[model samples]
Target: MGYPGLHRILWTREQFAVFRDASGQSYVVDAYCPHLGANLSVGGRVMGSCIECPFHGWQFSGKDGKCTRIPYAEKVPEFAKIKVWPSCEVGGMILVWYHCDGVSPTWQVPEQEEVASGAWVFHGTTEHFVNAHVQEIPENAADAAHLSFLHEPWIMNGVDLRHTKSKFWRFMKHHWKAEWQPEPDMHCSCLIVKHSLTIFGKHFPLLDMMISARQIGPGLVFLIFQHDFLGCGVMIHSVTPVEPLLQHVTHRIYYQRSVPSIIPKFLLWAESIQFERDVMIWNNKQYLSKPLLVKEDAAIQRHRRWYSQFYSENSPKFPSQNTGLDW
Candidate 1:
């Protein structure tokens, strides 16, 4: 958690509040108070291990979400309670478990020594709000064709893929060779990518690098990058859905102490330029359940089948304009 305070979380039109007690234990509960429907996160205060409602002097236990006290009433009602969400702190994030069927978490978020220990120094972070389905963002890793068509030009040529043929980028280009595969675990996948810079068709050995990314669950990814000149580091990529079609994406980078500080700054800058190219397309594109695919686009269909495990019969679907119903 950020601190011992109340934090509001808005996920897909549902409101929730995360309370961190003085002892650093986090609890997630519905944002609206059960008594009077007052937003708990607006003016709520933590009393010992309970959260006090702002509209009424009602206290709810952080551990079980049962109404502990009501100052005006002599005895609290037996049925008075608030919904409590399962939560845990892992990999420097306070994650609240969510499932369409209200089932317990089937998998746990993995931890890394580079983040738990002080060996890897924090360098920089980049955050973006992408207008797309959460599934579409991770699918980019499996769509290898986009690398040459969208991101082949150097960062200096700007984020517009249409202008990559300009004279300014004639001599500079980026090369990428990547492979994507599903791990043994049904909930996880992996992508291995190799990148290099070429000027006048000559490769620069110093700029060559390899990245191994592990996609965990629906919204978390850990990418480890190794470069001959810049050393090794890990980037934590997180995607949280704020609405049905909007996602909050963040990337945090950490490197060994031997790496220069300036290197990460330059990497983040260049990475942002490349990432924005995909963001522009996702914001305006429509999701096609049955896409017309060619032989070269086989991986895109494989990714869809692998990702289908995240959905269930009760899962929410985007509202369809044709039928005026959720599909």
Candidate 2:
């Protein structure tokens, strides 16, 4: 759940249910009921602070996933418990920790004062379902060369990378310069970008921006954007893997109240169009564990190395073509 105010969400394939308690604390747990294998999220009701199973009225605590009560039975079984996941709410998002080895979270999601203090107003959000590995999505931030070739075209030309290079839109072009580096913390990285737009060789002062993006962990990113005319805002970008090859990506933008709503809405629309161009390529690309790298591609390799720390020896691997059901 990238945004706030969502009470329950079920990932059917993963069998993970994210819900909140009566006091508004969020929790993540295995969706299946421990008693008879009934899906809890399908017909589960929040009774006080516990979740009541729709199948047999079994109540489970959202805090620790323990069986709170079995209405019709004399006593609850000792083994009546669900697998609870580590979760927390921060920066207006409900974040659930996922470690392949069932390890606890080593780092916490930092609270953004602007978001928590009501200083920033949520303007809008955009979501895209992409068929790609989770690593490939964040890797794009470190790939500086792709910015010139893939995203330099005008937004009006459309999201197709092939058609975007047409000479018809040559008069209007986007320019970008970026630098990425890993932070002192092992789990974070920062990308600083300078962007400008030109129309017929004349730069538009209002379109100039300096954006600082911090990638927190493998799936969450916070992009702080500042514009000369439109003021400033923060965009929360999150990536959640639903399957081995499918990911759910979302972007929620919050702007200062002084900035007009139309400014953020327009920016979100334009950003979505540009972002979809990368989505098209990511959906069809294959991940190469070893790739031919050049001098300019050093950052990509460095990013991969940094991201490797998140995996363990027992982490799940994609099944080989020969082993149909090894997983």
Sliding window of 10 residues with minimal summed lDDT for model 1 = 318-327
Which pairs in model 2 have colliding backbones? none
- Quantify all predictions' global Cα lDDT against the true fold: 0.85, 0.84
Model 2, 156-220: lDDT tens digits are 99998779988998999999999999999989999999999999999988789999999999899
Worst 10 residues of 2 by lDDT: 1-10
Which numbered prediction scores highest in TM-score against the true structure? 1
Superposition error at 195 for model 1 (Å):
0.9
lDDT of 2 at 79: 84
- lDDT, candidate 1, 159-257, per-residue tens: 776775678777999889988999998899999999998999999988899999899988888888898788888888889998787899988888888
Q: What number of clashing residue pairs does each candidate have, in the order they appear?
A: 0, 0
Models 1 onward score TM values of 0.93, 0.92
